[model samples]
Target: MNLAHAAPAAVDEGMTCTVADGWWSLDPERPSQPEPVKVVKLKSLTTGEPGVWVQPARGKLTDQQMHIALRRLSDCH
Candidate 1:
């Protein structure tokens, strides 16, 4: 899948995630931390809307993480 745009789910970038490793690391202390290389996708809850993309990085996210992400994405409207 093509990512329209994606950055680290990081505080420095103004985003926060609870995951430690993977793309969810938002800890500003580990500024050198890297997001996964393959895409971690968060499926859409609404019809006709594209899934929220994590980028060209791949990793596992908890169910709660997905829910939070989807909810946040929905708020963009």
Candidate 2:
């Protein structure tokens, strides 16, 4: 399994496991450190236009991961 780079915890900027016990580990400085609140940028599926997306007030996420998260959020309602 490929290990993705780990970002700092959004809440406390503490260390987290991106891929626990996986093949690789992320360099502490490589990933973005999240703030207390995070702003996400997304594209509209239908319009194919850029849109503003706000995350759940925290967490560092890549584009693909963010997309999946948004989909999961949409699914809940």
Candidate 3:
């Protein structure tokens, strides 16, 4: 899935997943610790799919960051 086209604004609007790509994640948010901005992969409540909910070690992601995170998560499958 090429996330280059993924819009940050769209993410902000709560469209977490792209079913066509079989992946989805939450927007990056500040954590309690001084760490990279984190995004949590969410499971499809209806499908019961397991999510790759690991916190990445990077700060404030650009569109590239989202792409990288998605790629890493995809590799785990």
Clashes of each: 4, 0, 1
Q: Find the candidate with the highest lDDT and give its number.
A: 1
Clashing pairs in 1: 37-57, 38-57, 38-58, 39-57
Off by over 4 Å in 1: 1-23, 26-34, 37-42, 52-77
CA displacement after TM-score superposition, residue 45 of candidate 1 (Å): 3.8
Give the winner by TM-score: 1
Question: With candidate 1 superimposed using the best TM-score fit, by how many Å does residue 6's alpha carbon deviate from the native?
Answer: 9.7
The digit string of per-residue lDDT tens for model 1 on 1-77 reads 96443423322222333223443545556643544322255555466334444342233343332322332321120
Candidate 3 lDDT, 1-77, residue by residue in tens: 84243223322212233322222323334223332323454332233433333343433332332323332232121
Candidate 2: tens digits of C-alpha lDDT, residues 1-77 = 95333322231112221222211113365443322223344444454433224333323333222221222122111
Where in model 3 is the C-alpha error above 4 Å? 1-46, 60-72, 75-77
Q: After superposition, how far is residue 24 of candidate 3 from its true place, in Å?
A: 13
What's the CA error at residue 9 for candidate 3, in Å? 32
> lDDT order of candidates, best first?
1, 3, 2
C-alpha RMSD values across all candidates: 12.0, 12.5, 13.7
- Candidate 2 Cα misplacement greater than 4 A, ranges: 1-37, 58-77
